[model samples]
Target: MSDDVTQDAVLIFAKRLGEIIATCEVSAVWIDSREPCAWQYIRRDGETIIVTCKTLQYWAVRDAAARNGYRLDVKPDEMDVMPGQQITRGIPHADKLSTLAVTPYLSGNSETIFRSAWGDGSEYPTLRRMLRYASTADDLGRAGVIGKTAQEMYGGPLNSSSKVQRARDTGAKEWRALSASLDTARDELIYRSTRPQKDD
Candidate 1:
């Protein structure tokens, strides 16, 4: 009911959440405080992350080095987008003829991100630059995207011939680099599976 009590509750919840996420593979997790409009962002990859203010939760865990802290009262730095996820201007809904159209009129950064994979705005170059972005079918499935793997998205790896696939491929160099990069990502970062995996 009181502000202190509410803060204490959030602190407790954050402590528990950190402990739970530590043992698994996670792209990002966060806590938002509506009162002050503060957010605590946690991410394992190279993406910029902020877990501000070292709340009671951080002190509870007593591991300052393990978490990156920011002051919620100040302006937080820009954060790279979460892996296996993309921002959309809107919902970018699949229209009535969405599935039937080959080069359907896809708009918005949300739709275009998937549509322009191989060109100047393509994702392969983006993925190559990231060096830490990765996901498995499991992760994509969890993200609720339509296709799970590059194969499912395009047809097969190293073969970016499909319309949706071409939107992401860019050129031979970017394509090859992305393929190898994803292979390494899938190999080194698999959370639960025993064999190598691939993802879109």
Candidate 2:
């Protein structure tokens, strides 16, 4: 799933996610449930941006920067690359979002990407798979991490509840431990994407 397939799946996923969030927000209004949300939380460095979000939210931003493209490096599981930073160098595009909940470099690295579900880059199972594909058995041993997959960590993929709980825990812990590092983010706002609807 590394080539066009992975890319296409991710594109469809982000596009669909944007739509779902918008729809859920809209539906909320029908019952007077809650006000619509138009922003996301993000952290970044010079040419890198890290978003600690549910899985959907992370893919919402990436390197490609086309309206729906993200060229991710998918770094090694043991590179100490920090959990969530794929080094995306720009802001996101969202028709709905007015602002992004921005902090500074919370993880030791300036660019980190995190998923509320997996707690760290342990969310990146692909990195491990790629290693298995490219490396000799000895190389894997040298690499040290077989693959700290989210499934391995939590017994299975996360659900909405798990994601919420992890995000709360990670956000609090990181904020407490790394508060001093939260420097002035560049003045910017980001993302709420919507694919154009077809004229049925």
What TM-score fits each model?
0.15, 0.18
| lDDT string, candidate 1, 58-121, tens digits | 4333222123332223432334235533221212222222221211111112233333333443
Residues 85-188, model 2: lDDT tens digits: 33333334432222222232122223432232224424334443334444655565444232322223344443345644554454456455433233322221
Once superposed on the true structure, which residue ranges of model 2 sit more than 4 Å away at CA? 24-57, 60-200
Sliding window of 10 residues with minimal summed lDDT for model 2: 184-193
- True-structure lDDT of candidate 1: 0.37
Off by over 4 Å in 1: 25-200
Checking candidate 2 for backbone clashes, the offending pairs are 38-97, 64-71, 83-121, 84-112, 84-113, 85-112, 85-113, 94-192
Give residue 137's lDDT in candidate 1 (0 to 100): 35
Best by TM-score: 2
